[model samples]
Target: MDKEFTPRIAAILCQWCSYTGADLAGTSRLQYPTSIIAMKVMCSSRVDPVLLLKAYLSGSDGVLLGGCHPGDCHYEVGNYHTRRRFAILKAVFDTLGLESARLKLSWISASEGPKFAQVANDYTEEIKKMGENPSKKKMFL
Candidate 1:
């Protein structure tokens, strides 16, 4: 049998920070996996837990919430709120016995093109380690 190496990842990027970084990644021509489906939000703090779960249910093997650095939210303190929200959401995902590695939160500033590339690359590798999510087994075509 041959091993498969492609991965499907969902990236939820805050428009202010992480999304811009991703854009920079594009303009810089830094190559990363094309598998990511980027969902742009105004702020990471705005990422509701329900939305995260919905993505999993929708077939993405992994979810990455990208946000601004602490104290850097254009919306003023949005990232601070996200810090609190991510903690609780992670707890719930754990209680549900989902792979913790399936969810990730990253802060990538608009100027950090390399950072965005690295994060995407690293996350792709992490989900690969986790292998196919068991929930995927139940997904119907």
Candidate 2:
């Protein structure tokens, strides 16, 4: 791999939970990869399938969806909805020839700053190993 090759990751973080966790990671000065571009949403369930696909097509090497833990969502059932949606999204990604590893979902609470940093580091490395998004390359050419 080229030394300059850096993966591009699109991260959708639940505003009430994962986003707060990420902010904590930042304030705590935890080191993580800088490859991710994060967007905060009211709930993880709000991350539409099209949005994930579009992110890949637009050159993101991976997509990460972070939300509250299964039973602790601020909106009660929001994380549950996210879980179901991600399962379907995974199947869609498979059907579209996208590797399942390139799309990930995690439950990160507001108190899990270390976990957030670790996730960022780990996902960045995973995306780097996967290289670029082939579909994006083809579409761009």
Q: Against the hidden reference, what TM-scores do the models get? A: 0.91, 0.93
Task: Report, for every candidate in turn, its global Cα lDDT versus the true structure.
Answer: 0.85, 0.88
Give a tens-digit lDDT track for model 2, residues 12-61: 99999999999999999999888978899999988886788677677788
Per-residue lDDT, model 2, residue 31, is 95
Q: What is the lDDT of residue 98 in candidate 1?
A: 72
Model 1 scores worst on lDDT over the 10 consecutive residues at: 1-10
| Candidate 1: tens digits of C-alpha lDDT, residues 1-141 | 114856688899999899999999999999888767798998898888678877777767888999989888999898888888888888987897877778888999999989999999988888887777667678563
Q: What is the TM-score of candidate 1?
A: 0.91
lDDT score, residue 42, model 2?
Answer: 96
RMSD of 2: 1.5
At residue 126, what lDDT does model 1 achieve? 81
